[model samples]
Target: MIRVAILISGSGSNMLRLVEDMTGDHPARPVLVASNEPAAGGLAKAAALGIATLAVDHRDFPRDRPGFEAALLRPLLDTRPDIICLAGFMRILTPGFVDRFAGRMLNIHPSLLPKYPGLDTHARAIAAGDTEAGATVHLVTSELDSGPILGQARVPVLKDDTPQSLAARVLTQEHRLYPAVLRRFSAGDKTPVMLGSEGLVRGS
Candidate 1:
């Protein structure tokens, strides 16, 4: 079984979706969930689901990113996860830390990518008068959100849509797309899965 370690922040909605989808007959198993905040709601949610959870509070270390990651790596390394999934993980990981996992790390971003690579994605899309907005699952390259795309699912920017309304819709697609992509990913298939108007299309 492929061992997956999920990193989360805040409510961990995506993390929960990943855990739920990876059960019984799935190609992977969620072995651990780690957070940068001790009070991250996901920690308790993950623990309640019987998965191991750990937190290395970044705030405690002030500006010491390396130190925080080092402490976070303790429980992480012990799990021997085959892959690390960043599900709403808020911390900006250092290159050294991200490099250690390299291609083994995956992240779900809130945009179609090669477009909006940072925060305020939905609002920006609306301001630009985009007809469609979406989410992407990609490799965790050193550059933030600049990773090779693995899969993407688009959602229409409905008429008179606010950022909040648009975000809610895109998030739903993220929950579905992330899991489907993961199932293929764990099976050693990195072919891009595009969920668009044409339905699910596979690419080389």
Candidate 2:
């Protein structure tokens, strides 16, 4: 089975979903759940599930991105992960760091991508009168959120939807989409996965 290391910054809701999915016949097993915040709630959650957890606090390095990444790499390299999943990992990695993992790393963004690349995706979509909003799981590249998409799950934007409500619905799709994409990706399949808001079923 392929080994997966998940990086997180907060609660790690996506990490939980990914870990839970990696069982029985799944191609990948979660080896580590590491975070940039020492007090991240996900650390406790992961440990509770009998998964190895780590913390490499970015605050310790101050303005030193390389130093932070270097410190982070020590434990990560020890895990020898075959695949790395950035599950709500908030830090923006440097090119040198991203290039090291390149094709082996994956991330789930809060937007459909090529539209809202950075933060505030839900608000942006709603403000623009968009009828749909969703999440995208993609290969990690040096550029921010611009990598090739491996999967996407879309939800409708209701007329009365606020960013928070819209975000809540999209988050559910993310929970389903990320794991499905990772399953295919870990097995060396790069074909895109399209999902709808109703369930994990494929979308047109």
Candidate 3:
């Protein structure tokens, strides 16, 4: 079984889903949930489920990127996680920290990715008049949301959809895509791929 660690900054709805999925007959289980904020709701949710939780306040550390990352790495390394899953984790990780985990780290983005890589994906998609929008599960890399994609689930963008409505649709896809991507990664399969101007192509 793959021992997983989840990092969160907010409500952790995705973390809750992952825990529920794994506690069943799944091949991976979240052994730890760490949050940069002590007040993160995910910590409380993890406690309710009896999962180990840790809080490492990033703000307490110096502004030096490497120094801050070193403090963040302690609990994660101690957990000895097979994979680190970022679920609503708001901080930007440095390259050195990302390299330590490399392909073993994963993140669920609200956008289809390579399209709306950063924030406000729903609003951007609507403003750009995109016909399709969705979620992406990808490996974490030095570049923001530029890593190889593991899986994606696309949702149609209706003409009258607002940002909130569009986000709701993409969020539903995230719930499904993230667990499926974890299963694939745990099985030692190559992460899925998507080509520019083309759609998804299965990786060998």
Candidate 4:
């Protein structure tokens, strides 16, 4: 089984799904859940599930991104993770940190990608009159949210959809897409997964 480590910033809805799905012969098992915020709700959730948790409070290193990452690296490496899944991990990792794990790191973004790469993605999509909003699971790279895509799950915007509503739908897709991608990815298959209504049933 692959030793998977997940990082989170806030409520770990996606992180929760990733952990739950890695059961019953799944190729991966979540061994650690790390957070930048000590009070992040996800830490509690992870602890409840009996997974080891780490809190490297970014605030402790006011002007030192590298320092914070170094602190973050210690616990992450201790787990000897074969895969690092960034599920809503808010911090932008330094390139040196990204290089440490390279091909083994992955992230889930709340947009179709190459379309919306940053925060407020749902709001931006609505403002742009986008008929569709979705999620993308991609390899982590130095550039923000510009990594090679591994999977995408699209949801259509209603006529009067607000960012809040659009985000809800897209998040549901993310919960599904991230885990599906991770399962296949753990097996060393980077084939793009396409999420359908019934679930991730095909590769692109």
In lDDT terms, which candidate is top? 2
lDDT of 3 by residue, 1-204 (tens): 899999999999888888888856677888899988999998999999999999888888868767767877887788889999999999999888999999899999988889998899999999999998888889999999999988887888899999999988778767767777787788787567332223343343
What value does the lDDT take at residue 109 in candidate 4?
A: 94
Q: Tens-digit lDDT track for model 4 on 67-182?
A: 99999998789999999999999999999999889999999998889998989999999999988889999999999999999999988988889999988888888888888899
What are the runs in model 4 whose C-alpha is more than 4 Å off? 197-204
Q: Give the Å shift of residue 16 in candidate 4.
A: 0.5
Each prediction's RMSD over C-alphas, in Å, is: 1.6, 1.1, 3.5, 1.3
**lDDT scores of the candidates, listed in order:** 0.91, 0.94, 0.85, 0.92
Candidate 4 lDDT (Cα, 0 to 1): 0.92
What lDDT does model 2 reach?
A: 0.94
Better of 1 and 2 by lDDT: 2
Please rank every candidate by TM-score, starting with the best.
2, 4, 1, 3
Poorest 10 consecutive residues of model 4 by lDDT? 195-204
Q: TM-score, each model?
A: 0.95, 0.97, 0.91, 0.96
Q: Tell me the lDDT of model 3 at 99.
A: 95
Predicted candidate 1 versus true structure: per-residue lDDT over 54-100, tens digit per residue:
88888988989999999998779999999999999999999999999
Worst 10 residues of 1 by lDDT: 195-204
